[model samples]
Target: MGLDRAASIADLRLKAKRRIPRFAFDLVDGGAEAEVNLRRNEEAFEEVLLTPRYMVDVSRIDTGTEVFGESFAAPFGMAPIGMLNAFWPDADLTLARLCKRQNVPYVASSAASTTLEALAEAADGNGWFQLYVSSDDTVTEGLIARAEAAGYEVMMVTADVPAAGKRDRDIRNQLSVPFRFTPEVVLQCALNPRWALTSLKHGTPNVANYADLLQSATSYADVQKTLITPSFDWESLRRLRDRWKGKLLVKGILHPQDALRCAEMGCDGVVVSNHGGRQVAFGPPTIEALPAIAEALGGRIPILLDSGVRRGADFVRAKARGADFVLAGRALAYGVGAGGRAGAERAMEILLLELQRALGQLGVPRFADVTRSALSDMPASQD
Candidate 1:
């Protein structure tokens, strides 16, 4: 379908599914085992309803907001997805460039296909690097120092994923980094000619950040052993912040006390996320934790949120409830997967327009005016 016909995030997702391979889509779309938390995150968005005010002149709406000591064109930004190139060619750079043009934050994952230097340069040193801490303090310290040298202004240490989630889809597809294809797997790739050709042309994908430190594993079992370990903890976060001289952010916080602890621990911000519901099956929805976390932070630190954010209305819902800004995950990746840099641009464009439209209808003159008064209590059953 044409871009004109793609009026909503759902439409863009549909387009993305058709263009990208099934394995790639599953990586972007799948969550933890059972996916109960994933479904709950989406459901939380629906539970909150906006009660708009009428007869208020809001012809000129300001969607702009400042977060992390930077002014953004809008209150929402792109959330990082690991191994994006596995979905589409050059996905990391494509999205980084798009975010740079749009003047919004773009997070780079440790598991991403591109390096921090490339993303920082492409994004004009405005990008944040999301680090997945290792058990070894020496390796973790070195990575943080490298990120600082790369000119990353924000250092986000992902506290979740102490152990990798049980993803059934990846197991079934046998989609490891250095892929080993059985007869059935080869046939599956052959059915999707574009994915097969790209894999052949580019050579198999490797984890960019870990490429130098951790070579491609000989088998899937080996990959699992290295990636999924129970060694990550609060000490890792302490070491990461101490080593990196930049804005420290803690992602994957879903508890009010945890958010408070982050601020006490000298974190500048905390992203209210459950790793897009990709890590925990029965965890609290990100939206459900926002108000409490925001209250806990009490303006000491910014609380950014992500998960199930697909529409401009979703951004409104998030901001009204307590989130300073919203982060889009699958929406942006799907956009990049569907097209390229253009698709990423289209994704941002759609959200900006939607935010403007929602602001106009809500009679809110500025994004700052969006308050708890604008939102009713979400159903308890929602979470």
Candidate 2:
């Protein structure tokens, strides 16, 4: 399908599914275990209904907002996604460039196929780095120093993956970084010649940030043992805060107490996410968890929400429900997967247009005007 015809994020996702191999597609699209929370995240947003005021002047709608001492053109930004090369060659750089051009935040993941410095340069040093803390102090410290040196202003420590979730789709597909090519996988790639040839020309995707460390490792399991921090805790956050001088935010927080603790510990912000339902199968939808966290913090710090944010109306719902910003992961990834840099641009274009239209329909002049009063009561069954 043409980019112009792909009118929504859902359309981009369908295009992505047809463009890439099943294993690669599943990596971006699937959630953990039974994906109960995955479905619920999107469903819960429908519970929030906007009450529009008629005959209001919305002729000058402004989508601009500021976060982390930087002004963004919109309240929505790209959430970090790992191994985007599985979607397209240099997908991380493509997204960074897109965000830079759009003047939106782009959080680069530690597990990305491109280096942090490369992504930072692509984003004109405006990108944020999302670190997956390691149990090893030296490794963690090295990453922080690298991010600082690369001119990343904000550091987001992911706190939810105490252990890896059981993602059944990846298990069934036997997905790995280097891709263990079984006959089934090979045939799937063969069917998608464009993706296979592009990947062949660009080279296979690897965890670029951990390239040096993985050099001595023999298998993906060994690489995982050296990278992920199964014991990350509040103490770890404290130590990281002391070492990293830039803005620090915590991702993967769903509970109000955890959000409050991050603020009390001097975190600049908290992203109310469940890792897009990739880390926890039964966790509450981010929308359901957002209000309590917002109330607990009382706007002490910016609270961003991720997971299942598809439409512009969903963005308005999140803001009305107390999210300072919203992050889109699968939507952007799907765009890149479907049509490279152009596809990614199309995704952002669609979102920007949708946000503008949503605001106009709601008779809100700016995103900051969105409040709890805008939302109608949830249905009794939904409540």
Candidate 3:
């Protein structure tokens, strides 16, 4: 009943689905194409089998990890999600505060409903801004300057999403950027009065990250056109790195060559993500790609991972395979959507506790010690 007692992200996910409108819920829950990738993401996590060892001093374990020169309380952090206000009034602020209290890094989306300065201040020094390259270079420059001035510790440039994915749920539910609910959607909103009243009291959500570059689009159609650009290139990444003083991370990298390219380009890190199965219809899950990418760029740059990370063991799998750090997007969405800051906090607590237990069982004292050699894939055996 209480927030701290929450056991799983699924608990929060159900709550979020109930509180948020159908369209809003679908945006966070649904993925591109036939949703095969989405299902595979979660299934991939379940596929990893851990061999635990006993008779070891497993009384204590440490999950703390340092990335981009800053120590984090855990090996994982929250990945940035767009249109956060759709879930709660000020979802960005909620996540920022929670990240501070939890001491895990919070990456703010470029399409979030809160301003860069506001989130940076709210998150204190734990904020990391996720940048979506704009079509205009001048706009991009200003955004870089804003994040630098806001005291963000890291600047993560999202290199995926050259164009918006064709999410069938969004189309069916009529959910877009500003979220103009159709009559059916309006009825769904009315059914969830708590969400409707709170949303009304706070005023409509604005695209805060692009507040200066463009006016906030009030409809789904308007927002889609403004949110993505197909022309985001290597030059854009170089320009962003040049302007931002903090650690620069490139998100949405899946290719091993691309991971090496980021290292060669002087990027600080690369998040091997398939946009949590939201963008591409098919690809190797982040876990499958972790080892190769990490092996290629292990000493060069921090290899961060996201996608299908539902529980603590998933983190172990990623770390053992090659990831320096892990991140979760939908799980936090489930948390915040389920019960605001308390729910989000519960999600982190659940992860940390589970991770601690997992570390002890695996005969590792430190989370980072669960390295590549600690794991061996199931081999073909005599039947």
Candidate 1 lDDT by residue in tens digits, 162-281: 778877777777776566667876666777777668667876666777686667467655654544346766665676667677889888898999889889878899999998889879
TM-score of 3: 0.93
lDDT of 3 by residue, 1-383 (tens): 56665677777777788788887788789898888788888887777776776688978798989888889889888898877887777778888898898898888888888888898888888888898877666666777778877877688888888888888887787555444556897798799898889889988877787765456556655565566668888887776677777788899998999989888888899999999888977877788777788888857888899988888878888887788899988887788877777778778778888889888988887986786545646342410
Show model 1 residue runs off by greater than 4 Å.
219-229, 378-383
Find the candidate with the highest TM-score and give its number: 2
Q: In lDDT terms, how accurate is model 1?
A: 0.80
Arranged by TM-score with the best first, the candidates are 2, 3, 1
Each candidate's number of clashing pairs is 0, 0, 1
Q: State each model's CA lDDT, in order.
A: 0.80, 0.88, 0.81
Error of 3 at 33 (Å): 1.5
| Per-model C-alpha RMSD | 3.2, 2.5, 2.8
By the TM-score metric, which is better: model 1 or model 2?
2
State in Å the error of residue 313, model 2. 1.5
User: Poorest 10 consecutive residues of model 1 by lDDT?
Assistant: 220-229
Q: By lDDT, is 1 or 3 better?
A: 3
